[model samples]
Target: MTVAVLFALFTVLLIVGVPIAFAMGLSAVTVVLMFMNVPLVLLPQRFFSSLDSFPLMAIPLFILAGNLMNVSGITAAIVRFASALIGHIRGGLAQVNIATSLMFSGISGSAAADVAAVGSMLLPAMKKEGYKPEWSAVITAASAILGPILPPSLLMVLYGAMTGQSIGTLFLAGILPGLVIALFLMALTWWKADTIGGQKHSRATKAEIGRAFLAALPALVLPVLIIGGIQSGVFTATEAGVLAVVYALLYGFVTGKLGPGLAWHHLRDAAIATSSILIILGGAALFSWIIAREGFPAQIAEALTTLTSNPYLALGLIVVALLILGMFVETISALILVTPMLAPIGAAYGIDPIHFAIVTIISVLLGSITPPVAIILILACRIGGVDYAKVIRPFIPYFLIILAGLVVITYVPAVTLAVPRLFAGYGG
Candidate 1:
């Protein structure tokens, strides 16, 4: 009855369009006041304690690194490099849109940031080149999903912080699956070149390709630096974030692009972005405490295990639930609310933690591209000056493509486990 009341209030708040942070915090507070014997002060304590994680520090640093990269001209370099590499292919701009997101995803770690940085540049270019605004907008938003799939992922950080999975292992786990998923999108774009109104250009000269790579070299180095530094024991995951920020600022100053005023502006922007995520997590912490106090995770795990001894069937059920939850809730908040409950369920089914974590993240990220709560998609729509209704149609094919990719990654553990295993003795 208490669980029913708790979720009932949360659903009502969401249906009425309260911000997720307030909705979660309010629902938990209401439930505690009515039924739970927990002191009122304990509610706020849960909120603050959840934010007190060491691994969680990576959240803002990674966000700031991604932001600084977007603003300090590195994003343009990445776009240029992506264009040089594949913009001459069939549906060239569409290919570049995916490539730029794939490259930028490693830095920004946030889907909205990917949409803002990459979409701001490519959505206009694609539209100006005779591609439909709806198509351009959908592609930009869909590709932005790569941000959380690839390394330096904000979602993975939260999952690891909450569930105690290895952050570095999750980062490594995303590598092959991330690239393969990008290939899946690229292939779809290539096959549907005519559908998207693609244009082809002559292949770049060797010299032109070389020049673009050289220009984008610094941005590329940062990902390698973080991964290599962490893998080699030079730094922990949180420290790698610090390394990323210091490197971005230094690169900006050296290029004379990130002056004091510009740096402050970007800092303010990243802080705002970071604060929003932290606020949602705080609210989730309160809700999660109530859920924990009620033994919801154990109950859900017992029910799931009793229903299905088969791991794949269990995963499919969880995926379906997550997919449905994602359409209504924002991605990160949904992640926080569920990871605690889901991780134990996966363990009961004998799924590898690393594999389970990646699959969980990919499924949740689909929400960012889906409607009602399509946070990233909303950004692309605004950038392209198109209405939400217009893009949803074009989003269908990409949605199907992403779904197919998810199926492959879900069924084949090797797709996710291989790279992580080779790199760090993570489960195979």
Candidate 2:
């Protein structure tokens, strides 16, 4: 009865267009008021408690680091480097688009930021190179999802905090899966190069490649600093975020790309973005608390186990459910809401938490390109000036490629676990 009431009210609120945080808060409160004897004060308590973790401090810092990097002109450097490396391909700009996203993913940790920074810069160039606007938008949106799948990922931090998994292991786990997805996207771009018909350049000269790599080397080293610092026991994940911000500030100042005014503006923007995410998280935390109190996670695990004792079958069902849920819910909201319920179930099926974390992140991220709430896709379309309807058709192939990569990551734990095991000697 409590679960039904909570979910029913949540559905009604979503349909009525209340903001997600408030919708979750109201639903949880309403259920508690009517059915449970819990004090209303517990709602506020849970909200504060949810945001109290040290690991969660990484969220705002990473957002700020991404914003600072954008203002500091690091993105242009990375793009130039990517272009030098891959611009000779048949679909030159399209290949560069994927490569740049793969590089930018290390810094931004947010797909929306990836689309805004990379898409805004590359989509116009792609159009001028005679690529279709819809295809340009599709590639930009599709590749940007890699941002959250790579190290320094915001979703991975949230997952770690919620599941009590190591953030370092999650970061390490994402490395290969992200590369696999990037390779798949690049392969698709290469295969369709003739159909896309973009201007191709000669392979970059050795001197040209060296110059671009040197220019972008500062930006390129950020992922190593973050992942390496954490894995080497030099800092905690939260401390790594501090290092990221300090590094971004120093780099921006030295490069002269970020003046006081621009720095202040970017800081304010990061604050607003962080506040929005944390609010959703606080509400989802309360909602999760209510669900857990009712033994909902165990019940879900039991029900899923009854349906299929096969671990592979259980994974398939969870992936399908996540993809479906991703279309409706915001990715962070979905992550916070589902991780608590599903992680335990996944464990019961003998799934590695690290493997499950990568699968869950990738699965939810696919929604950023799908319809209704395709945030990354919408950003790309708006930037590229392409019709959303036109881009969806071109988006299908890339989506399938990414979906195939997700399946490989799901079934082959080594794809997600190898790096972590190699570095830390612990798979989970």
Candidate 3:
């Protein structure tokens, strides 16, 4: 009865078009008030505690770093680099879109930021080269979702903070699958590029290639600094974020693009983005407490184990469930609510939490590109000035390509564990 009421409230609020954060808070409060005798004071406590997490500090910094990279002209350099590498291919600019996302993903970690940065540049170029606006928008949208699954990803940081998993390991786990998705998306784009051969392929001059590489060099160094710092134990994940911000500022200054006033503007933007995420997180934490206090976790664990003792089967079910939940709830909210419950079940079945974290984060990220409530896709639609349905139609191939990559990362534990194992050798 309690579980039913909880879900009922959640569904009703969602259907009514409440913002996800408020809906989560309202449903949680309604359920808590209805199901138990807990005092209202606890709501404030949970809200504060959720944002109080030290590790969560990474979220804003990562978001800021991605935004700074976009504003500081890092994205442009990387796009040029991608263009030089893939522009001579059959479907050149289309191929460049995927490759550019893959490169930028390592730096930014925010999918919406990825689309905003990469889409603005690539969409216009692709259109000028004679590709349909719809196809151009769709392809770029599909490619941008890659950022949240790649290293330095904001989603991974949120997953780690909410679930208490190792952030470094999750970051490492993203590498192989990120690359695999990049390769497959590039192939798909190549096929499409072949079909639409309006642009003349040009091999970049040696000087042009050198100039692009040099231009991208500062931005490319950010991922290395971050991942390397974490892997080497030189800095905690939180500190790596601080380093990212400092590096971005320094790069901006050195390039003469960031003056005294520009630094303040970037800082202001970072604070706003950070506050938005933290506010949602606070609401989610309150909701998570309600669900947990109502015994959802225990009930779920018992039900899952009873239904199928097989770890693989249980994992498959959990993946499908998360994917579906993702279509409605925002990714961070889903992780905050579900990770606390499902992670322990994974542990009970001998699954590594780090492995589960990678799969879970990646699975949730798939939602950002999925239909109905795809946040990144919506951003792309607005930026490219295309209709959502038109954007979604040609996106099927790229979706399947990414889905294939997700399945590979999910079932094959080694794809996730290899880097962590090699770097730290702690997973034995």
Candidate 4:
């Protein structure tokens, strides 16, 4: 009765256009008043307690760092470098979009940030280069989904916090699968370029290549610093985020790309973005607390265990259920709402927390690229000046390719576990 009431109210509020954060808060409150014995005074305490975690400090700092890089002209340099490297290929600008995401993913860890940083620069170029604007939008959005799977991912941070998994292990384990997704996207872009040939570019001289690399180096350095600091035990994830902000600011100013005015504007934007995420996180935390206090997680866990004693079957169900839920809810919201309930069941199966985190992150990522709640896709379309319908069609094949990648990573735990194990072994 408690879970049902919570679900029905949340669904109705969402359908009625309430913001997801408020919807979660209201629904949780409703559930408490209707079904639970808890008092209303507990709400404020729960909300505040959610934000009290040290690790969650990374969320705002990373968001600020990403927005700062955008305003500081770091984004432009990386796009230029990507274009110089891939712009001579058959689907030059398209490849540039994928490459740029791969680069920015290390720094920002948010797919929406990836689209904003890289898409704003590349989408126009692809349109001007005779590529269909809609196709350009589709590919850019599709490729940006790789952002979450890459290191420094906010999803990884959330996963770690919820599951008690090591953030360092999640970061290290993500590198290879992220690379595989990039390579596959590149190949798909090449084939699409062949089918719809655009204006091609002349090969660049070695001097030009060197200049582009030098120009792109600063943008490239932020991710390495964050990931390295975490893996080397020099900083916790939260500390790494603080360092990322400092590094982005220093790089922007030293490069003469970020002046006081742009820095101020960036700070404003970052605050708004960070606040949005934090609100959602806070609300979901309250909601999850209510559900847990009602003993819903334990109830659901027992039911799931009864259905399947086999770990593989349970994990498979998790992936499928997440994919379905992803269709309705946004990825970040899905992660917050589901991970609390599922993590314990996964542990009972002897599943590595890091491996479970990878599957959880990737499954939610798949949802971010699909219909009904594709925030990245919508943002890409807005920036690219293309209709949503036209852009979505071309994404079908690329989406399937990415789905295949997700499936393999879901079942083959080694792909997700190898890097973390090796890194831990070497560290020891």
Most accurate candidate by TM-score: 2
Clashing pairs in 2: none
What ranking of all candidate models by TM-score puts the best one first?
Answer: 2, 1, 3, 4
Error of 1 at 392 (Å): 2.0
Among all windows of 10 consecutive residues in model 4, the one with the lowest summed lDDT is 419-428
Point to the candidate with the largest lDDT: 2
lDDT of each: 0.88, 0.91, 0.82, 0.83
Off by over 4 Å in 3: 196-198, 205-207
The CA root-mean-square deviation of candidate 3, after full C-alpha superposition on the true structure, stands at 1.8
Per-residue CA lDDT of candidate 4, range 24-80, in tens? Answer: 999998888877786788898888877677887788788888887777787788888
> TM-score for each prediction?
0.97, 0.98, 0.94, 0.94
Cα distance off (Å), candidate 1, residue 97:
0.9
lDDT of 1 by residue, 25-137 (tens): 99999999999886688877889999999998898889888887777899999999999999898889999999999999889888889999998998888888888888888
* Candidate 1 overall lDDT versus native: 0.88
RMSD of 2: 1.0
lDDT of 3 by residue, 132-184 (tens): 77788877878887788778988888888887777887888888778877887
Worst 10 residues of 1 by lDDT: 419-428
